[model samples]
Target: MADDETRVDAAEEKPAAPSDSDLFRQSEIAADYVEGLLDILDYDGDIDELVSAGRPVVEVVGGRLQALVGQRGATLEALQELTRLAVFRQTGTPSRLLLDVGGYRANRRKELAAVAKNAVEKVKEHGEAVRLEPMSAFERKCVHDVVNAISGVESESEGVEPSRRIVVRPAD
Candidate 1:
């Protein structure tokens, strides 16, 4: 029937999701961009490009990279945005490329997990909601993951970017 044919045509018109190869390519582009930055800054690092969790990831590992991380990873966040822009310029598509330098993200995630656990414990013991300090999207996600894995507690984010924070409460 014509209806079936029209339905098929509509489905075909939908934009296809980026394949794994496409994500990997984004990582490659981001890696190259980060490498150029390191070169310009006269910094030494080992860059690795890959696709992880359906997103591109560019990790730079090296010594004396504290400046790149900056205070509370502000510089690193800026670099990630710049690297994402570089990928967008080359591929004509926005990128969700995660850029990690000097194992900052990994270390931060561990610290956040501990913080989340503490928040959950406080919420459980007091049977009251506990508000945490404002955190970046990445940090909020890390805390959410830890809180979600533990029972008897729930977490939610409130407010806007650069000021958004998490609130952990006892499960109703």
Candidate 2:
């Protein structure tokens, strides 16, 4: 009986991980808040929330949401932080949140990945460093991951925020 209890305990001891529904709930709450804000501002944008890359992401699409995104997405970044703060206040847990406006983030990430791939090919061909255009931290991270996956090459970021650029070079 003791051995049986031990087996049961071990079986129940799976690694702790949040469920997808829990993550989706966070996105839903964020979307509701964002929708209310849009309504208050008399903005016309469709809000969508979903789980992407294991994190909650909210996307607002419409001409009016452009202001929420701001110049170079500065306003969008600020709004994301504020949304995370609101979520944390309610759930008492910090969130790895992602917010996209007008599909900018999704489109930008795709473009950055392509740029990174091109730089990787250039570095492999010429054995010289390839400097990419300035990108946000999230964009840099995506590039870094893509570059890191390839052998004989590496990527690193230089300069400061809003001006930070990624450089891909040979592994050696």
Candidate 3:
């Protein structure tokens, strides 16, 4: 019909959202960047790139790659940001890319989950707020997700970066 044709024509004038293939391209760029870094560092690792959780993820698995993780994943986090920048430079889009080396993130998530559970327990038992030590944004997010799932308890992030912490308290 004429009306339908008109609508289609008007819609075509507006830019569309990024498609799945565009997102996949971001991962490809990030993977290439990471591979170059690995070559420069003379590190041996297997890289797998994919899109997950609506973001690009680059996973590196190998032995003796603990140095890539740094102390408490600091180096890994920095690497992720750098990869994201590489993606952005090519795509002109900011990315929420995730980079994991040697199962570090998986291990850290399990450990942080335990810490969150402990905080939930303390809040429930004492009916008082329990404050956790300062953590990176990723760590705080993991803790928040765990605590938010439990009933009668809640968690909030306070303070600024490098000093920010989570506080678990009884729900109202």
Stretches > 4 Å off in candidate 3: 1-18
Ranking by lDDT: 1, 3, 2
**lDDT value for model 1:** 0.95
TM-score quality measure for candidate 3: 0.88
Alpha carbon lDDT at 130, candidate 1: 97
Local error of candidate 2 at residue 134 (angstroms): 3.5
Error of 1 at 41 (Å): 0.7
**Model 3, 1-172: lDDT tens per residue?**
9999999999889666567687788888988999999999999999998888777788999888988899989999899888898999998888878888999988999999999999999888999999999998889999999999999999899999889999999999
After the best TM-score superposition of candidate 1, give how far the Cα of residue 118 lies from its true spot, in angstroms.
0.3
Q: Taking the tens digit of each residue's C-alpha lDDT, what string does model 2 give over 1-172?
A: 9999999999989655557887898898889888888888899998889998789888899885678878877888888888888778777778888999998788878887898899999999999999998887878988998999999999899999879999999998
lDDT of 1 by residue, 64-144 (tens): 999999999999999999999999999999998999999999999999999999999899899999999999989999999
Better candidate by lDDT, 1 or 2:
1
Clashes of each: 0, 0, 0
TM-score of each: 0.91, 0.80, 0.88
Of 2 and 3, the candidate ahead on lDDT is 3
Candidate 1 stretches with Cα past 4 Å from truth are: 1-14
Model 1, C-alpha of 161: deviation from truth (Å): 1.8
Worst 10 residues of 1 by lDDT: 9-18
